[model samples]
Target: MSPTFPARRRGKARVGAALGVSATLLAAFGTAGSAQATSATVRHGVFPTVSGAAQIRANAVGQASSDETLSYGGGIDGIGVMSGQPKVYLVFYGSQWGTQTTDANGNLKFSNDAKGGAPVAQMMFKGIGTGSEAWSGTMTQYCDGPLVSTGATSCPSGAAHVPYPTGGVLAGVWYDNSAKSPRAASGHQLGAEALKAAHHFGNTTPASNRYAYYVILSPHNTNPDHYQNAYCAWHDYNGDTTLTGGAVASDVGDFAFSNQPYNMDSGAGCGVNFLNSGSAGTLDGWTITLGHEYSETITDQNPAGGWTNNIAGSPYQGQENADECAWLKGVTGGVGNVTMGNGTYTEQGSWSNDTDQCALTHSTVS
Candidate 1:
């Protein structure tokens, strides 16, 4: 992820330039309950400007004729999905998010007093796992290999297939008031706060957190770890120092997290591009960005060690699957609005190595 240095703030470290560790290291030090997660590649998209948009469009990675895969020397073992029932927990990190309610389908709904994007995020997470949505299956095409940097194409025999989150769970929600505001919460601070919530929910051990990820949301009107400028949102495990104020690799487990602010502050910069429908407060971008991070987390749970391209000098390299297809909309294998059981959502496509294309739907896991 490139850093968005605010014009007024000249010397601060760009939040996108944070240090990242490997899942192998986390495995060496993490306890059983704290294990499953590993350090992930911090893939992020820059805020789009007219000139920037033109440049990115010219250089953007287009859909491939078949699934794409990087060589083994690039990182670690191959990348794979959660391979189990996935789980997600939502954290409203500040008081800015007010009360919450439950909709008819047992999905969490926030009060109107809260930012309009909040409830939409909640519903998208819930609705995506149901109705046999094809959006998610787009991720199943990726698989992990047993050897590091070997360029071995096939997954090891008996390797777990990227299971569809058939019965994915929205384990719980927490409104933490301790932060009170996102004005100064650093990336590390956000990870620590997520740890606090994990502790509160007894999700501390790796076994307890298997296939589980935490999403830390900053409120509107404030910034968390430079979100307004540097990047819209990002997903990473604990212990990645590359991010300013991130947890130390040795001290934390393989817990995954993403810090996002309400996108109204900077539309394309904060992930409200393409199908934003010309509304600053629209939930389309919010849900799409969230889905992007979620898909990346499960596939590249520990960053490059999972699945990532490592081409030199190419922004697209080292990018997770979703990053490759970030803003490609309306073309074959690009972004489009799809109807789920709850409602229609404008989401982007994910890269699939199987067909060597970016696809919105996968008839089967392959």
Candidate 2:
């Protein structure tokens, strides 16, 4: 099959929230930071230009409270942090995605329809030539509110980008594998050791169709009714009044995984659900993780790319992540930074078709 997604923005575009940026921190990141998880970095080398982290803060618009704080260490998710035209394997579990199919390589198999009738969680993520890097990263205290809900009711101030997985981190059986079972319970991603093992077993390759599973549970999970509306349940469940263990949907089918860490019954290590430990997971964390690993693939494939852009604006209010100025643009500009609730400002630069890297004239993705 082909990797042709509908490209429609169904879920609300998440607003920037609770992310802090600093020059010192970003400078030490995967790129200029000098760390290569795979040969991709060693091959092209790491980016060596920019330094420090950009500030990102979403302010109080109308619905949210004026007293919420969010901080995120960039690269929260193990996203490879590359820079290239990388393709994320989006394993959707529902009739819409069809049934399980295999490629000639046998490296990546697919079963779009998840077991248990629920909407199969979308498992689209950045990839490395060898394996996957994700996050157990934090989202503590940086959400605007719920975007869509089945029956969620937490008092939130803004619109949420990703909703809680009603199915929990454990997406489905046949088609969609449970991302929660990875060795690194936090990122729910396959670590360096685990990836080599999968390679040894010939279960995967370093080319097309690499899938990274991310969790977006139902409203009940995000502690619906709580202030942050976060998912505080994983093991014993948190004592929030809005807590709903939730039901498993029956619609899932061929997309289930029998593999460890990817399968529940297969003895795979389940996720720790950082929320269970009491934290306000931010949308910024999830988004940044996705973006970081994404850019890495298309660029230098490692920390050797010429990341790091020049500065432009000053911080908005007192918020660190908020009120950032735009500098780098496109592939060369760099890939880091955060934004406020409003996108007037952004952290780190991204590959915007609107303009080239480091272009002063910004254009909307229209």
- Return the top candidate by TM-score: 1
> 1-366, model 1: which lDDT tens digit per residue?
211111111112222223222222122112212111122212232222223323444544462333244322222222334666667888888766666667676655556334367666767777776787888887665555443233443455555555676644467777776647657577677787778767877786766655778888877776665544334566766645455554534223467677766766665544455675556326666777788888887776644445654433343534567766666666767768866767777787877766666778886463
State each model's CA lDDT, in order: 0.57, 0.21
What local lDDT score does residue 337 receive in model 1, on the 0 to 100 scale?
81
Query: Looking at candidate 1, what is the lDDT of residue 241?
Result: 48
The superposed Cα distance between candidate 1 and the true structure at residue 325, in angstroms, equals: 0.3
lDDT of 2 by residue, 279-323 (tens): 222222233323333332222121111121112121221112111
Q: What clash count does candidate 2 reach?
A: 93
